[model samples]
Target: MKSMKYFLLVLLTLMGAHYVEARPVTLVTLGNSLTAGDGDDGIGGGYPTRLVSKLQTANPGSVLLQFGISGDTTTDLINKQLTPAVAALNAAPSANRKIALVWIGSNDFFGFYNYTITEAWCSGMGLEACENSEFGASADNASTILAALQATGAALYIALLDDQSKRPVITEPALRAATFPNISDEYAARMATHLSAYNSRVQAHADTYGAQTVDFFNTTIFEAPATLSDDGNHPSGAGYDAITDIWHNAVTGSSPSSSSIVPNSH
Candidate 1:
């Protein structure tokens, strides 16, 4: 009788351990079109979908709550998205592990070169001056976003934006002329400088707010034609596939694998 009781206790302990190991996760994704699946219109719905699928293998029944709007700037996220994101985090199961992923500032950077620089607020300034002022405002808003998300008690992961000016849409002359008739080589160069500066601000905020910074700045994935969509601005299906790998590697602290990772949909 004593031996049988000991065996039962050990079996119960092992079952409890298995349950904890497979505890569900609550993942919140926050950003703009890139997070919203702009370029790839396939059923996968971009990185968030693919990421959740990968996460489920380790943590069964993981849930994703995405808050992404196309053309949104840092200011837009602060003004509109934060409240609901917090609500979702709060509503998640008490036992679930919480995480938030933020990838923004692309629109903020693009708007500065395309429109903000020409606005009356920046009327008399040179390219560099206007760029600084515009990106400065964006950086401040981004910091606000990070702070709020950090306060939610979720593990935060923020992605650094690449220099949009170097994208093929702007680098290829014919495409540039078609997209922005008035844009010049000088404008593109100035944009790159300001974008790099803005990325530093983003990195500093991530550090201060206790978020991990996912390095998207140095990847040549965006520069490769095969990774770009027909519009040349967004990532193609293949590009998103590569993006999924990069993000998974960061989250799992594992090397990126080219082999199949997505689970069967059916």
Candidate 2:
């Protein structure tokens, strides 16, 4: 009977371990106003909340935490958002899945544009040089955030910023230059080019860190009035659902694009 008693104790220990392993995952979203569900229906809980619900259907007990501060840039993410997310992810039980979804840089571009044009800040750097510098800094800051997220061993997905040029705020001449006063079409086009380059850098980072990319830059919801809010920037409730559908596809391994998941560079 001594042998039987020992076996029971071992089985009980194993069962306890299994119970811990069966706990829910945590999905952390790092983004800006849109990710916060700024313009969505009801009380402004948008895609992230819907995404949490969707994930719960598959990962029953899974929970979500959104750190999407409006006007947050890549620098803000590095200086403010990264530390807490990394800590939470690392502190969670090792068996639980730690996942992160990052989408930022909206204010970074605006900030860069304004800073570059300011006579005092620009001095004699020349507009092209100033823009390039801002672009590079944004990319570098984003890389830093991604590295921190990767360090926590979380499954990472970094979204490429959408084409602001398509947004109503940018297209309408009066509203377009609201942030970057007197911004010309030609100059805005250059900004879009810089944004594209930024996205390329984002994909490169994902390749380095075994993460994924969601190509909102190439996504079609921009001009679709139904997908965008009345203001033409943040997504509507239906837009959130559409965004979540795309995210769900990526999470389920059927990535929207063939190159969505970056291959790790050993």
Candidate 3:
């Protein structure tokens, strides 16, 4: 009877261990308006919320903790969001898998084009030099955010920023005239080049730290009218849905480039 009782205790212990190991994961997203679901016309908070639902379907009981502030730049993320995110990840159950997703830098570009130029923040520095300095800062800030998240032992996914220069706010003449009459063709061209370099730096950071990159470069969501919000900047409900699929695919080891996931309204 003593031996049988001991055997039963061991069996229950193993079952408990198995249950702990199989607990659903925790997802923490850190970013700007895009991650905050600014233009989402739907009740779903944003891609993070949509993603949590998808995650729960596969691994029920999954949780989402999002830190997305509108108009936040890479620097703002480091200053405001990173600490809270790290704390949350550290507080998560050790047995549950933890993941952090970072998507930012749109406002960095916007600030450069809109405020920097208008205010002449780099008046004497020359446009090329000013761009290099600004973009370099953005890259470094992003690297810092990624590195800190990695330290929490959570799987990290960093988003490659879309080229903001191509968004409807810039490409559409009417929108440009209404919103940013000061942004000339030359400035727009320079922005495209700098944004590309910034994305390359982000990719390098992900590679160095073994974090996966969620590609936002080749998507039509920004260019497509249907996918863009009424503001012509942030993603709409359908666009957020599309973004959710991309992140989901990246997490699941599937090709995120599937046409069904990234829709082209063109």
Off by over 4 Å in 2: 1-23, 177-180, 255-266
How should the candidates be ordered by TM-score, best one leading?
A: 3, 1, 2
> Across residues 1-266, which tens digit of lDDT does each residue of candidate 1 receive?
98885675576467542112345678898889888888885655878998888788777888999997888998888777888998898888987778888888988766666677677767778766777777888887767887887777787788888878878888888877777655578778887887788889888988898878888889876788888887778888888888888887766554555312221101
Question: Which candidate's lDDT is highest?
Answer: 3
Q: Write the per-residue lDDT of candidate 3 for residues 1-266, one digit (tens) a residue.
A: 99985675577467542212234778999999999999899765989999887777666778999998998989899989999999999999866678889999988988888778765669788877888988898988877987898888888888998888899889987888788777888888888888899999988988888788889998988989888888788899989988988898877554444312111100
lDDT of 3: 0.81
Which runs in model 1 stand beyond 4 Å of their true positions?
1-22, 256-266
Q: How many residue pairs clash (N, CA or C atoms closer than 3 angstroms) in each of the candidate models, in the order given?
A: 0, 0, 0
TM-score pick, better of 1 and 2 = 1
Error of 1 at 167 (Å): 0.8
Predictions: Cα RMSD each: 6.6, 8.1, 8.2
Encode model 2's per-residue lDDT on 78-176: one tens digit a residue.
777788888878787755677888988877776665565766666578878877787788877777888888888888888888877677767776666
C-alpha lDDT values of all predictions: 0.77, 0.73, 0.81
Return model 1's CA RMSD, one decimal: 6.6
TM accuracy, model 2: 0.82
- How many Å off is the CA of 61 in candidate 1? 0.9
